[model samples]
Target: MELQLGVLGVGHLSTAILQGVFEHGVLDPGSVLLADRDPDRLEDFAGLGCPVVPSTELVRAPRILCAVRPQDFPAAAAELAPLGSEHLVISVMAGLGSDSIRSSLGGACRVVRTMPNAGAVLGCSMTAVARGPGATDDDDAFVERLFGAIGLTVEIDERMLSAATAVSGSGPGWVYLLASAMHDAAVAVGFDSQLADTKVRQTILAAARTLETSGQPFDQLIEGIASKGGTTEAGLRVMRENGFVEAVVAGITAARDRGDALGAADQ
Candidate 1:
């Protein structure tokens, strides 16, 4: 069968995307083509029956997913510059814009820029997508449906993509850091390592489920758990005193700024 989808890189995020697509029946494995510089990585995907092709051949597919690293984009774009206007190019590369991609690829192909978190590995990613100038409504829907198989997707203005990158693309690391802290605290309190890990994981999961289902304001959810003079409230008071909220805001801002810097370099 002819390849319908082409992936430009075979890194962790690319593997997650392929896994989600295959596991969820989004596309047939045989119809997917993969290209990467590393033969080992290509072999890994080849073992799963995906055809390994040269990067130069990626343009043959009607839909192409660019998962290459920011530093590697110039080379990949050179390979894809020959793609015709019929190609729909979707890029998951952080800090790179659709405009940059379009310019690099001869300004002809339809392009979409997306930020999908590590949750894609578990089919729970929070993805934000923005279309380039050449993209049409059909292109938008096609990209959205392709990503929707892996997780929730939101459409946003390209201008806000950096902020989305900070919040959604970089957000998983923040959550994981909090989980690690909670687990460490549990262990310090004399809990066994296994119990600490399980408790912290379940606590985070339950809290996330509640937030998802409650439809309440975040403050309201917090108030529900941290009543005045309660243990939760006491802990929150310490966190507030220690500027936890400020720290989190600063971290997000830094990530956004870094994204802008990366985009600037590409421009």
Candidate 2:
């Protein structure tokens, strides 16, 4: 609560984070300043009693959270260029590296980059934090604390952040895709749409809980459910024959590669 935070954008990810922090009592609404190009987006925070400030005045807070889209960073950077050495800037913009952010923000502001998924809305995000040049231990701990309010936090080398972006940041979408496929398949096979949706949702939740508590490798878990010549085996065999696992690996790799490409382009 002692930290006076300034948030420069209120897009989906930022909105989730702010909602989590406020819901969990991690920070008081009154201590945070919010800003966004779209006034409608700021209305939620404003309703929560968080002060809305102009982007140019974000530097007034010692710790600034930059959640702007990567394409919009240049203009946001111009407004934040006045940040001094004492300021710490936490960025959630995908594919924008710390070096690029620091240079654009007057070359003195401390930068910490993080990737948190939309799960933060319910305080279950798996956030990855990477400390940047000139960021102190205190700064790193502060970043961890802020993200910990939403869920678990992992500190990783900045070089691996792109991989983290693919695995955790975009991981939810992949799961949803699989769930949707299963739901539609159930409906196609004669279950009512509502029943298929409910069953699929429960199945996913149960499987996730089992995976967390099983203490076994994924292959072993899969093998347990798939007996020889059984129904599970039949479905799994078709998936294997159709390159399901390979497709998943390739998809994640492509996402990581795209993130790298975006960062390179920014540089």
Candidate 3:
């Protein structure tokens, strides 16, 4: 909680991240070093008991977190080169890897490449991480802690970052896709829109909470709600017969491939 942290952007993820850091006891607000090009927005860091500096000044902190957009990567990473080998570069930019970041920072800063979804704002995100070859176990552990400050953390080979992107990173989009379909289907079935919205929302949330808290087997729990010869069972039968899971899996595969294409382009 006492370690130095420099947050290098003032965007949504950065702001939500800053808030999560405060709410989840990741670091004392006073210990955070913040920077952004927009001085007006950077002032938000003030109430958190932080020091707001010009972007270049943030390079002084040993644990530098780059939450800027992919387009800003080069300039931002360049500014931190002076910090050199001492700083661990943890980045949240998609389509850019640790090697590119380390390369931009003069090849000595240890890099941690991570992908976190928008749910990070809600403290329920799943973060995927991979380390630069030079990174030590302690560096990886620190990267884990940094993301754990918000939600779940999983480490994998850097090669799988695209798979991680296709899943958790772009997962919220997939979840939203299903939710939207469900919502529209409910309204199509002669239900009031508001009623349909509330039912879908509560049902999804209830089922998720049950999954998290219940010690029962998922099939048993699901079967309990979907009895023999009931509406839910009939719907489940239709979904299974129509290959609902197969379609979802296909979408994820496509997403993963696209991410791979993007990475390959950078080479």
Candidate 4:
């Protein structure tokens, strides 16, 4: 069978996307081609029946998923300079815009940029997709289907991608930081380390599920748990006093700024 998807760069995020789609039966190995600078990575995927082709051969597939690092795109782009409007370039690289991607690939291909969070490993990522110049509605739908295999996807303007990067893309890292602190706090309060870990993890899982399924707003949900002058309120008061919300907003803004800088550097 002819190859349907050509995957460039088999790094952690790309690997997770591939695994999610493969395991969910959204795509099969026979129709997917893999390429990476790392021989070991290519060899690993090759064992799963995906042919490891050079970047130059990626043109054989109409749809190419480019997951190379932001710093590595120039070289990868050079190798795919032969691509034209017939190709659909789906890029998941952080900080790189669709315009930049198209220009780097000789400005003759359709591009779709996406930001998928680390939860992709668990097939629960929140992915943001932005259509680039020359991409059609069909292209966007195709992209949504691909990323949707790994997680929920939202379509936003290309200009808002930097903000999306800070939120959905880096949001998991922020949650991880909060989870670590909660685990530490539990340990400090006399819980054993193993038990603390278990408690923190399960709490996060349940809380996330509730946040997704509950129709109530965040404040309402918090109010449901934290009665007036209760233990939960007491703890929340301390967090508020410590400027937790402000700190999180500031951190996300800083991350967005960094993403902008990375995009500027590429341009």
- The prediction achieving the highest lDDT against the true structure is 2
Q: What value does the lDDT take at residue 114 in candidate 4?
A: 91
Model 4, 59-93: lDDT tens per residue? 89989999988879899989989688999999998
The true-versus-predicted C-alpha distance at residue 117 of model 4, in Å, is 1.0
lDDT per residue (tens digit) for residues 1-267 in model 2: 454799999988888888878887878998898989999999978998998989998787889999998889999999888689899999999999998999999899899999988778878889999999789999988788789888889999999999999999999999999999999999999999999999999999999999768899999999999999899999998999999999999999999999999889989
Lowest lDDT 10-residue stretch of candidate 4 = 39-48
Q: Deviation in angstroms for 100 in model 3?
A: 1.1
> Which ten residues in a row are the worst by lDDT in model 2?
1-10
Candidate 4's TM-score: 0.91
Query: TM-score for all predictions?
Result: 0.88, 0.89, 0.92, 0.91
Residue 37 of model 4, lDDT score: 85
lDDT of 3: 0.83
Q: Which stretches of candidate 1 lie over 4 Å from their true place?
A: 43-49, 183-198
| Candidate 1 lDDT over residue span 113-200, tens digit each | 8889988988899999998878899888878777888899999998888999889888979999999999999999999999999999
The candidate 3 region of ten consecutive residues with least summed lDDT is 77-86
- Ranking the candidates on TM-score from highest down gives 3, 4, 2, 1
Please give the RMSD of candidate 4 to the true structure.
2.1
lDDT of 4 at 267: 77
Ranking by lDDT: 2, 4, 1, 3
